[model samples]
Target chain A: MMNIPEDISPWLAIPVVLLLIGGSLITLIGTLGLLRLPHFYQRIHGPAISITFGAGSFLLASMLYFTVLQQRLVIHELLITAFVMLTAPVTAMLLMRTAVYRDLRNGRQSPDLKPPTPPASGHATTAGANSPGLMEETRDRNPE
Target chain B: MKLLVEIALYFSQFCIVLAMLLCMLRLLKGPTAQDRVLALDTLWICAMLFALLLGISFASLVYFEWAMLIALTGFVSSVALAKFLMRGEIIE
Candidate 1:
């Protein structure tokens, strides 16, 4: 086995240790939220914590630990960091769109889909006027 | 300091394992297909971090490569699942 360093200064070691622990704890909390939160949309918000700050802290701790130990800039970890940042939201949005589509297809009345009540002035832009199909669908559903 | 690092490593690993188990619970208990897909996405992410922590624990650069591969696989699988959900099929 390669000899692991045993003499990291407390200043450097303390923060890295703290970061790893804190990051893991946050990730645990996020996953707990995912398991406990009711409804698809509410549960959708849970993983955001792990995808952002949870992964972020661990990445930072790893980068600092490797950089200090190797005595050179070690940045390949950035690939995972960048990948997570760029793709996590895309995945979440896609899943969210899929969930919304599925709910609409089933004719489920999710409270989230309800557009705000427009004023009597009659100048409210239909919530999603850009999508005429969905707009018409919702209007038909709530013919008030 | 070495002992401290060791403790942190073990603690992080424990937390990640717990998270992974929770994700599995969601995956199995999901009332909808989308929920299962989301759980899978989160599970792979936890696995990736688990590999990374292993890299640190072993003091090997190899596990870093493993971490990268896991990340790539997680993103691809999640994207594919989401696309499948968007369309009725994956390949068209």
Candidate 2:
């Protein structure tokens, strides 16, 4: 087994401590947001905090600890980190879209009112009242 | 010094387990399918962290690898669930 020198102690310990505490706190915040946020779309922001910064910090701590202990570069942690960063936004986007679709299907308030009407159809048609076709259209336009 | 590390590892693991329990509460209490899916995602993250802590405590690389795979599969499943929620179908 390789040994890490004593000189590296201060450098390693501080960052590890920081990562551990910071990651835990962020995760707590995310959970709180999940619980406290009033609506599903609003609640979506909460886990983004965990998936991004919280996971990032944890991964940093792991990388530092293992690299120091093993006395070599440990890059496998990066694979997890990179996978998280790449997939988180995609998942969040999908969740958001799904929330919107569900709300629309149930005739709940539009979370955002900014999607201007299609140029050909100048007005935002209230799909709730008029057309079964509109429901099918929304589903088709944003297929799962 | 070994005892100190063990204590710290145990504490971290405990915190992660507590978080997972909170997530389970949300999963069970969720009023919407989307909310449950979010809780499931959160639970997966906690479990991955727990696995990492176990790996560190035991000085094992295999647990770390297992944690990585869990994260990957969790992401895929959450995305698929979200997609299903969106269009009421997962496949074309």
For candidate 2, write residues B1-92 as lDDT tens digits.
44344445566666677677777878887777888999898888877877776776666788888889899889989988988888778997
- Candidate 1 chain A: worst 10 consecutive residues by lDDT? A116-125
* Predicted complex 2: DockQ: 0.36
Number of the top-ranking candidate, with lDDT as the measure: 1
Query: Candidate 2, B29: how far from true, in Å?
Result: 1.4
- On a 0 to 1 TM-score scale, where does candidate 1 land against the true structure? 0.84
Give RMSD (Å) of candidate 2 vs. truth: 6.4
Runs of candidate 1 exceeding 4 Å displacement: A1-3, A111-144
Residue B66 lDDT, candidate 2, scale 0-100: 86
Q: What is the TM-score of chain A alone in each candidate?
A: 0.74, 0.71
Indicate which candidate wins on DockQ: 1
lDDT of predicted model 2: 0.73
Worst 10 residues of 1 chain B by lDDT: B52-61
